[model samples]
Target: MGAATAAALVLSGCSSPYDGAASTDGRSPGAPGTAAPSRPAVTPTATAHPPNDAVGRQMSWMLGQMNTDPVSSDVSSRFTEQFQAEVPPAQWLVMLGQLRAQAPWVLESVTSDGKAGSASVVAQGRRYSLTMTVDDAGRIDGALLKEGAQGETATTWPQVEQRAQLAAPQVSILAATVGDDGSLEVVHRSGEQGVRPIASMFKLYVLAAVAEQVRDGALSWDQQLRLTAQDKTLPSGTLQERPDGTAVTVREAADLMIRISDNTATDLLMRAVGEDTVRAAAARAGATHPEGITPFLTPRQMFWLGYGDAPQALDARAKWAAADAQTRAQLLEQVPMPGPGPENIDMTSTPWRSGVGWFATPQEVVQAHLYLDTLAGDAALAPLREILTKNGGIAVPDWSEQAFKGGSDSGVIALSFLAPPPQGTQRRQALVMIGTGERPVDEETFVAATADAARLLSEHR
Candidate 1:
C-alpha cells in the first residue's frame, strides 16, 4: 500500500472495501468507551534511530521534554477531565495510567558528545544511541549523533534522504484538494517540466475519452465488446490467452484496463474513441507528452492495451510462430494482416512486451491525472477511479494507501497519486514520484522515500 491508498482507508472510515470496519484482527476504530483493560506498566523505552533518520531529526524536540519536568498521569487525567467536564471514573483511571507509562525521557548523555549530537540509553532490553537534534518547535536543526558497535547513528536521517534523492533523480507528483466549500484544486506537474512520454498513465486520457463518449450518447457504459486471441500481450499484464468469442462489456474493458492494466482492453477502448481523439483529449488537458501513434501499435502497447494489429502478409507466418498460442489464434481470427503464418511454433517462449517507444515526463503524467480528476462524477470516469482505487498493478505496502495509475518503461517508472499523511493530520497533499535510473530503480526505496516525504510535509503542515 502507498500513503495515498492508506490515507484513502483512513478517509473511507474503513481499511478497505473488502475488509470490514475493524482491523484484520478485529480491532475497532473508535477508542474503547469503557474502562480499558490494564496491561503491565511499561517504562519509557529509549527510542533509538540513525542520526539522519526520522527520529534523529526530532531528537532536539525530544530533548526539550527534559527541560520541563515530565508531567504525572494525575495531571494528564485532570486535563482530560477539565476538557471533558466528565471523564467517568473508569476512563480517568485508564488515561492516568497511560500518561504515567509514556512520559518523555531526558537526554541523560551523549556518547561522542560532539556537535553531531549522539547519545546512548539503556531502556527495556535494548540499548540505543541518539542520532539528530530537533528544536522545541519540532524543527530539524542539528547534526546527527554517532553510533557505536550496533544500532542507529544520528546521521541516519540525512543518509536516507541522500539515498532517496539518488535513487529517484526525477519525480512527478500529482495531488487533489476538495476544500471545505467543495471547491477542487487539482494540480498536475513534473519535477523539471519538459517533454516526457507518459505510458500507462495515459489511460487517464482514455478514461476521459470514454466519459466524453458517454456524455455524447454514442456508447453505453454497459455495452459489451469481444476479446479475441489477438489481444493477448503476456508475461506481466492481463492480456493472456482468451477465445475469439469471449465477450466483455465496455465497462468491464474499462475496469480491466485501469485495474489490471489490460492492454487489449485499452486497444478496444482506443478504437471506440479513436487514437486521435485520445491524443486530442490529452492535449486539451495540457499533457506535454502526448503524441501521435504510429500506424502500427507497438508490441508493448499491444500487450498493454490487450491486442495487436495484424502482421504484413510476407511475415505473418513467422510472427505467428513467435506469439503465444492464444495470441496467434487471435491473429488468425481477427487481425487483418497481409503475410502468411510462420512455420515453426514455440508456445512456451514469452518476450518482453515493453511496448512502443513511448515517453512521458513526470510533470506531464501528473497533468494527465489532473485531467482525469476533472471528470469527477461521470459514469465512465467512476469505474476507472474505482479500479485505480481498488488495485494499482504495482505492488505497494498494505499499510500505505493509494488510488493511482502506474507506468513503467525500460528506464522510467512513473506514478501520480493524491495522498494524505498516514497519521491523518490536517495536511492534504499529493505526491508524484518518477524514477529514472541507470539500473532498474528499487521499488522499496521509491516507496520509502515517497512515504517519508509525505510524512515530513504532513508534520510541517
Candidate 2:
C-alpha cells in the first residue's frame, strides 16, 4: 500500500575553488606617501563557485515534467544520458505516476553537500527527503525520495511504546519475538489482542494459499495468465502500467504480489486460485476473524467500497457479504468500479471501522507468517525469500535472513517481519507492528517506533 517514487543517481566530475580572499598588509607598496605606481590591479582570480542552484533548477524541471508529460521521452531528457540509459523511461513513468496519484508535493528546503544535495518535500500530510546529485553540466545525475527523519532522538522500547500510545491514542501496538524453538515471547504490547484493521498484511494468507496449491500440484509455477483491463488495480505495482493481455506466469505474479504488494497481481491470483482457497488458508493460519476478508477485495474494489459515492455501492457490499457463495458471486459481478482520479472517500474518518477492509490481531498476523513458513519448506519458499530481500525499507543489518510485508491505508498501518536466528543458532524471530486510529496515523512516528522495536528485539535476542 506504499506509493513508490523514482530516485535519480548522478555521477558528476566537477570541483569548485575555495573563495578565500587574499590580503596584503594594508601598507602602501612603495612608501606611506607615494601613491604606489599603478601596477595593473591584480584581478582577483574568479572563484570557481559550487552549483548551489543546481538542485533548485533540476527540481523545477522535474516538477514541470510531473505536471505535464511525465511519461514522455521529453521528461526522460531531464535526466543525464547515462541515467536514462541505465533506467528505462517506462520505469520512470511508473514512479512518476505513483507521485502524481499523491500530488501537490511542495518543496520545503534544499541543502547542498558538494555535488550532492538533499531536498525536503511535503505531500499528503507527510514530509520526505529527496536527495539528488548533479553532473558537471548541471543535469540531474541521481536523486532519491524517502520519508524525512523526525528530529526526535532515539529511545528505548518502553519509551517508544509509551510515546506511540500518546501520539496515536487509537492505535494498538504489539511487539514480540519468537525464537527458533517456536517460543512466542512478548516484549511490549498494548491492546495486543484487538482485531484492528491490518490493510495489506492479509495478503500473507492469500500468498500461503497460492504456495499450498503449488505444493499440491493443483497449480503449476509456470502457468501463464493474461492481464485483462478488468484485472488492473491501483498503485504499488507495475502490472497496471502493462498493456492488457500481457502474459505472466503464476510464480511471477505471486512474487510481485508479495514483494511489492501489487494489488492487481493479488486480485488476479486470488481469482485464479479461487477465493475459497485463500479463506481456508487464513483459517488454517490461526486468523481469529477470517470473516473480515471473507469476500477478498482487489485494490480497486476496496477503493470503491471504502470511497465510492454511489449509495447502492454500500447496499451491494452488504448484500454480497450476507449472500451465500453462489449469491455472492452473482452480486460481485454487479459491483461498481471506481473511475481513475482522486477518490471521494474521506480518509480522515474511520472508514475501516465500517468493515470495508481486512482486519487481524497481532498474534494471528505473526502466526500467519510462521504458518506460511512451515507450510512451504525451504526449497519451495526460496522464491518468497528472494523477493522479500527487495524490501530495502525495513532491512536490519544484524539479522542474517529477513523477510518483511507491510501495509498502510488511511488510518491503518501494519508491518510484519520474519528474521531467522544468527548462524549456528536454532532460534528464529518474528516482529509485528500495528497502528490504527480515528485520524490518520503519523507515518514518521510509527516507522520510528517500528525500527526501535526491531532493534530492541534484536538486542534482546
- Give TM-scores for every candidate, taking all chains together and pairing residue i with residue i: 0.48, 0.71
lDDT score, candidate 2, position 344: 49
In model 1, the worst 10-residue window by lDDT is 16-25
How many Å off is the CA of 77 in candidate 1? 53
Task: List the pairs of residues colliding in candidate 2.
Answer: 8-142, 8-143, 9-141, 9-142, 10-141, 10-142, 180-427, 180-428
Q: Candidate 2 on 66-130: residue-level lDDT in tens?
A: 54544455644467887777556776776677666666666666667556777666666655666
Q: lDDT of each prediction vs. the true structure?
A: 0.43, 0.62
TM-score of predicted structure 1: 0.48
lDDT digits (tens) for residues 150-259 of candidate 1: 21221333433454554445554433443433333553333554544344566667777777777678777798777655454433234445567677778877776666
